[model samples]
Target: MAVDSYDFWLFDLDGTLVDAEWSYTRDVFDRVGDRLGRPFSDREAEVLWHGLGGARDDQLREWNIPPTEFWPVFHAEEDPQLRAEATYLHDDAAELIRSLHARDRPVGLVTHCQAFLTGPVLEHLDIRDWFDTVVCCTEELGWKPDPAPVRHAIRELGVEGEGTGVLAGDGANDVGAAWNAGLDSIHVERHDPAFRGQCVLGDYRITTFRDLGQ
Candidate 1:
């Protein structure tokens, strides 16, 4: 049997590649609040973070944090420092990227992370050269589980045909993104110790990218 049905690979940055611990942003949020003259407790920071990848408007309204000021404050004071902190990568990730590169396969990075943040993280990890393209999409292009960024990666990679691509990552958003883009998904949930079963949303599930068969 064929190991994988793809010549083009779309990857998610945070959990799937480097362990950005994307879900944790309390420290940064706290800093943002401090800079704005409002101190955020851990509780308030958690509420703001859910807004980061989720409903911005609702978060703004509920927290009374102004949308116009929140991001700028966050980016200027918190993002760079957090980017440095999130630079660690999984052990087998680079091996998989290299294996694909050896075969001359095309790879694209589709991340919901900000360009400034993602750019430095990729550079710091030294694996940025492996990907053919990188789309650091934010609210403008839509986030994962919404399908917009997946489609954006697909279009930018310019790979021929539908089945030629597969997106591999650690979260449901990756699987959902692939499904939304009419491609397959491989869930690499090894790093997620809390995860204990197969993902129906994922076309395939593996402990690591090395398990992707030839």
Candidate 2:
């Protein structure tokens, strides 16, 4: 099906819609390491970045870093401005959003990214205005792979039928969420062993929206 095939579109942020380099992953973990004196390894950072581990606290458990202690320092390393600057969107992403607008289809963003980061990144990318709803973890929608968030976004878009909507994301959770909600999924693969596609497979795999075909 083409990009315009669906009446309602639920998207994932971070890797799907935006090219969030998260250019600060290394720097953030480095700072976290300095404070904890545990030091983050490059491979460890990649694992974290890939969403391989459930949560940072869980991932740090092996390293013996206390969640209570590590969270504060890790969160502190989040540089909103730096993140805003580092995150960008694929050229075709903009075209996809505009095409959806022109088609008068309702689009909502359901992301694991909390609001503090999601808001600025969306604004910086200049595409927030295009979405009908943005459900992030910071809110009550819950995180991806659970399906509640995707289901919520579908409802927010007021979609009534099963095949009317589809979730397009780059993570296994994204695929799981769609499966839970009984909706289709499109996997936009950009990187391997990445939150971008890791074990989660999609109903449709496309490197870019154009792969949807005319």
Candidate 3:
């Protein structure tokens, strides 16, 4: 199948386009630990960050901090730093986006990450103009797996037709979100069991962006 066959492409930000997992976690844990008067190590940060998934409420529960207290502290400390360190992008990411755009394929970004976090990353990467629409959690529509945000992205891109839209992501929630939105999903995995059975649920599974053509 040709890439243009997909009228629009929806992508997850973190882990899919940008590598913010380490830096994001470090900041979140540092802020949470500071507010709780506890020590947060990098290792601990990893655990807590991965636990966040696409659910904000669950993350708050894991950190044992209310959103009110958590947001203030997190914004005060981690936000700026995360924005700074999120300059890096996956190899060939820019080329891929450019190619997609050249083909007149509308590209949209739907991330569970809030605007505060995605804003800096987008600026740092200097690819903000690449996307036709961005649906972040801060926008109030809803998060991934709910499908509302995904559907909103599709609507923004004005995509229509069977298999004309694909949601490319790196997690189970991404898969579920695409499924719920009635769009084909492409799971990107860097290693074995990157998504386990989750990848099986996707219409396509690729180890790299290049596989999209195959």
Best by TM-score: 2
Model 3, residue pairs in steric clash: none
TM-score of every candidate relative to the true structure: 0.74, 0.85, 0.79
Among these predictions, the greatest lDDT belongs to 2
Global lDDT scores for all candidate models: 0.71, 0.76, 0.72
For TM-score, candidate 1 versus 2, the one ahead is 2
Ranking, TM-score, top scorer first: 2, 3, 1
Candidate 3 TM-score, C-alpha based: 0.79
Residue 160 miss distance in model 3 (angstroms): 5.2
Q: Candidate 1 has which clashing residue pairs, if any?
A: none
Q: How much RMSD separates candidate 2 from the native structure?
A: 2.8
Candidate 2, residues 1-214, lDDT tens digits: the string is 8876777888888778776464578888888888888877877876665555545446678768777897667767887778888887887677887888888888899987777788888778677798999898643556677878887777777775645778888767787788888888998776664442335568998888778854
Query: Which residue segments of model 2 deviate by more than 4 Å?
Result: 52-70, 160-163, 193-198
Over 23-117, each residue of candidate 1 has an lDDT whose tens digit, in order, gives 44666766676788888776456434433223444557677878778777877764655565666888777877777787777899998678877
Model 2 Cα displacement at 106 (Å)? 0.7
**What is the alpha-carbon lDDT for the whole of candidate 3?**
0.72
